[model samples]
Target: MVNVGLGHAELSSTHSNGRVQEERRNEGVVTSWCIAKPSTDDESLNHNIDYSCRQKGVDCRPIQPGGSCFNPDSIISHASFAMNLFYKSAGKNYWNCHFNGTGLIVTQNPSWGTCKYPA
Candidate 1:
């Protein structure tokens, strides 16, 4: 079991190979989120949003006006959402979260109210 603060998730596994030989693998899912670093400047954050939003699979609609995450509309808020979406969609990897060194991977969810950061 993994305690992710949000809740506990049971670890799963899989078996492979034929009856003659077998292999087992634990398919544990780790939840994580990416967001703009607190120290990142407005310019950098905006750049991250621009770059991330342009990428495929990154839905920037949530950050648009009248969108669920549009309130509290600020560079930091919007950038965090866009960067996280890009990181999640691009493949949750260390490099994916490295938005010119302005991105951070956090175990704690950055979600709030209707703003849900994907994991």
Candidate 2:
């Protein structure tokens, strides 16, 4: 299961309606961190972003964790800016973006050393 944002919100598998389903709940204030691992293709980027948004309880479409298109250089830069803003507003470290394999990964509560950005 992926921990999206604050609230204990998780995407868990459920067995209902004769098929497996995804259940979402507002648990309140995401405490655990989340990671998005994408494949090495642009087509998968959208799925990755969707996964992240679902995990975070946010409206992130056309982009889900493990998807490809989600790794735009401009998007990464913008994400950094948003992370900085979140840190400043909340007075707590929040989001981070990094390149791994042929894709990008977004993580929370990530170690500073894990960042691939230039110093």
Candidate 3:
């Protein structure tokens, strides 16, 4: 989700079932944050991601087979998502994006093709 203005309404577009739908509403204020990792696999990153998922009880079902985030599924992809969730839950602060060297913070939205990141 993107905030159009300060205390202003924003339009959200959702693509589902071959149709594009849009709506206006105020859900929550969003700040720009992106957690990215290298293509190379790292054990520490995996460990942090796993511990985060279990400890926080994050709902990762959306990344499962037949789920919304299932496409382009990979360890790195899912880990980035989980890390982002952790940051968002913690109030979208710079510190929240720090996952003990597991991620890098970027100003970009980090939303992939058809994969909407929490704003």
Candidate 4:
């Protein structure tokens, strides 16, 4: 199921047995990740990556070739990973995730396959 609000959307899935399973965004947990807004262009994302990766404690190794988070190989994916690392390393502040208004703080886990995004 998908719930589309004014400026946000929520998604859920159903198992083969026909049971609806909602996304794990609730349950009294407060986890956040910094991701590039979908409307952000590649040039902006690249700029974000450059800025975030240069910060101290922002380890961008996982997005390098042969790294766990390297499979997607998309500017958005890499930018999101790098941005999140910078955000997490910078104390998870709202401003830390703000990459010139191109970043967004999301509660959903963007992890895919073996690439686990840090919370």
Candidate 5:
């Protein structure tokens, strides 16, 4: 068991195939990780995600006009990037993944085209 107080913690148990079985906080045996998935286009949600990033000081340059992930031009896409940035950079945890309901954590990498979602 691993314990982190307002910090990052990754207690991983892997299988023979090098796949992690769990890497997150415990909730009566239910566990989950902060993985980036697809995002939604809800304006309110997107605003929340972007607001969270700016408030948390997450580097949002990549999603700017001439940035790496600006081509998408979609709120969902932008939010996805921002959400993942916080989720991974700020410490992969429920709070980071919880982008006021804009974040959708999944097992697969959501990187596409030139936008790379950090793993």
Candidate 6:
């Protein structure tokens, strides 16, 4: 069991293949992760985006709304001025996958993209 603070806890169990199963959390409630799979259309779109990011050498993880590209060093790798410029050119939809303050909020649309900073 891993405590995430404020009464939030995550419990993991190993599968036969040595893969860890993660419990899905929704507003503190637990649910089946597979049940949360996106619709076919949305799934394809996300897959395309994920492929694009990967082609650029960006390590990204798929989330409910969209995906997040992260640098290996996380915070340290986020100090690139060129990256900032790239994100700016990528428009308001592109987000920094580092700082929690503003990167990409996954709950707003949950269809295409979401704002990093909630208003």
Global lDDT of each candidate: 0.70, 0.30, 0.55, 0.74, 0.55, 0.26
lDDT of 1: 0.70
* Better candidate number, 3 or 4, judged by lDDT: 4
Of 1 and 3, the candidate ahead on lDDT is: 1
State residue 119's C-alpha deviation in candidate 6, in Å.
22
Best-performing candidate as measured by TM-score: 4
Whole-model lDDT for model 2 versus the true structure? 0.30
Model 2 CA deviation exceeding 4 Å by range: 1-31, 38-40, 51-56, 61-108, 111-119
* Top lDDT hit: 4
Q: Alpha carbon lDDT of residue 6, candidate 5?
A: 9
Q: Estimate each model's TM-score.
A: 0.75, 0.22, 0.63, 0.77, 0.59, 0.19
Candidate 3: segments with Cα more than 4 A from true spot? 1-30, 55-57
TM-score of 3: 0.63
Misplaced by over 4 Å in model 1 are: 1-27
RMSD of 1: 11.3
Candidates ranked by lDDT, best first? Answer: 4, 1, 3, 5, 2, 6
Q: Which lDDT tens digits does candidate 6 get at residues 1-119? A: 32111011112233332223444466994431101112223334333344334444333343222433131222211222122323333442423322222222122211111212111
Q: What does candidate 5's lDDT look like per residue over 5-93, in tens digits?
A: 10111123323222233333446543333433333446764675657577565787887899977756766566666777777776666
Regions more than 4 Å wrong, model 6? 1-14, 24-51, 54-119
lDDT of 2 at 63: 25
Worst 10 residues of 5 by lDDT: 2-11
- By TM-score, rank the candidates, best first: 4, 1, 3, 5, 2, 6
Model 4, residue 31: C-alpha shift (Å): 0.7
Worst 10 residues of 3 by lDDT: 3-12
Clashing pairs in 1: none
Model 3 accuracy (lDDT, Cα): 0.55
